[model samples]
Target: MERLKLDYNILVIDDDKELCALIKQSVTKENISAEHCYSGADGLILLEKNDYHLIVLDVMMPGMDGFQTMKKIRKQSSIPILMLTSKNDSMSKVHGLRSGADDYLTKPFDMEELIARIISLIRRYTRFNFVDNHSQPLTYKGLTIDFDSRSVITQNGTFELPRKEFDLLLFCAKNQGRILTKQQIYEEVWGESYVYDDSNIMAIISRLRKKIEPDSGTPFYIQTVKGIGYRFNKEV
Candidate 1:
């Protein structure tokens, strides 16, 4: 018998009650169930008590804020987190993504865009388990991706990566030796090419390299093809 597929449960942690309600209404369609927590502190409590597939977090909460909340969450789970902030500055995005957020969106964002990002993360985390004809895991050098278990074995360690990061690295690994432009990467990984934001891709790549490469600065697995795109080092 096949397991019945259920909608993904999402947690939204923000101080904006009205916006939370709006997001809950907007994303609570077909295969998504949205829940709200008015503050990061409250959200953490809910996190401990329940399971959620994705978290939509606000960066400017009253007390703990998104970064602090994310830090605590990372200590416990690798659930996909999409950070929302009013700040468009690069540093905020860097800090959020580096600390554990799977993606970031600025405030006053298009609801459609938010829904797209939320769905992308949920699908990657919950629905993906692709294998070739022989059901062999993908590997290069010491890195092995077990799609069945959603785990990766790297030179550093065998780790269960957050869904978005895993999918990003998997794509690069599979298409080794080919130049993948930002457009292609976004379209393939995000399922959209409209929002050409380099910060998000760069953040995920940075996080991936840290896990797999000996040194992120001198990456041996994925190389940036200056001015054009990235190439997964085929020689590896």
Candidate 2:
């Protein structure tokens, strides 16, 4: 099968000049344009001057690290970020995710896996941004989801969710009353095949329930289907 050519620019922030060059060369083959900077500070400056579809950030850098850079970027934009780190510990991965990274890849990673993750992040981001004129806002009970604007509203007030959260919610809302498996949700929302354990999906669902459910302890909208997966209750 012929691969679809992607026309997107990505910013690579890493002090390792060799790796940056390699990543640029690799992604260019897939029709992805990449720009690189040697430092986090320089990366921030470039980000201010140009628009990028996604970011490939190295965790360990001189002065400001990837976590610090990610925090700064999160203050201004919700652009998808893929963090590259040498640390393989679970805590480091958790920290990266909590610091606004969309995905984390440890060093000495397979180039193909890195490319796959990058494409998945970009595709997921693009899918959410693409608006359909024919689709209408979905309202159930007091919760309202505006697909065109990519906003969610509840009885509490309007909430602006992170990219993954919004995508997961939209998927569930669209398939209300249907039992969605973990693999199904992961593949659909993440834009990749499910490989990791169920913890990732479980965490996202827990977070989503907190945001939309009146009582997350007793989630009314998103119901657990026991060991199977979840079902967005259309009858809520």
Candidate 3:
């Protein structure tokens, strides 16, 4: 496949020097600049000095594991993160996502898939960050979403959600009163096909509800439409 020419920079954090070098080489072929660090500490230092459009983080390391590194990074930056893990278990993937990773790839992944995911992440990130100067914030009830700032305000408090969650909420808000299928939500928000089961979407929706819903158990903003999908309550 011909790779799209992207001017984005990506950071790769892993303990394996060979693997990092390989990943850097693969992404560079697509005109996407990449820098890598063998340890989480070095990655953190590099992140402090440079701006990165996305990150490919490995879950296991000597110290300050990817989860720890990612948690610290999340405190300061909302850059898209795609976690790489040797473990193929669902729990590990879930942990990565909950720890602020935007996506995850199992070990021995195809180079094409990695490049595709990298491109998709950067594209979505660029789209979400691009806002019109004259655009108005979306306001419903006590919830307010500032598109330019990517901030969310609710009766509970103000929140700056992680990129995926914020994008999901923004998509739902834009199409309020419409029931969105899992496939639609996945392809749109994830910028990928809907091959996996609905677990990913459900996880994100659960997290979003906890943030914006008055009661997460009985969500007021996002309502599930039985077996079809979910609908953002227009009456909220």
Q: What lDDT would each prediction earn against the true structure?
A: 0.80, 0.82, 0.82
- Across 103-194, the per-residue lDDT of candidate 2 in tens digits comes to 78899999988888788767656654553335667667979888766777887678788788888888776555555677768987889988
Residue pairs with clashing backbones, model 1: none
lDDT of 3 at 137: 79
Q: What is the C-alpha lDDT profile of model 3 across 1-236, one tens digit per residue?
A: 56666578999999889989999999888989999988889999999999999999999999799999999997898788899999989878766765667778999899889998888778656654653335667777878888777878887788888888988998877555555677778987999988968888999999888878888999888898775577778575
Candidate 3 wrong stretches, greater than 4 Å: 132-168, 171-236
Q: List clashing residue pairs in candidate 2.
A: none
Distance from true location, Cα of 2 in model 3, Å = 5.2
Q: Candidate 1: deviation at residue 32, Å?
A: 0.7
Ranking by TM-score: 2, 3, 1
* Candidate 1 runs further than 4 Å off: 1-5, 128-236
Is 1 or 3 the stronger prediction by lDDT? 3
Tens digits of per-residue lDDT, candidate 1, 111-220, equal 88898878766755653334444456777688788877778888798888888887788776655545567776777788875386899999999988888888889989
- Misplaced by over 4 Å in model 2 are 132-236
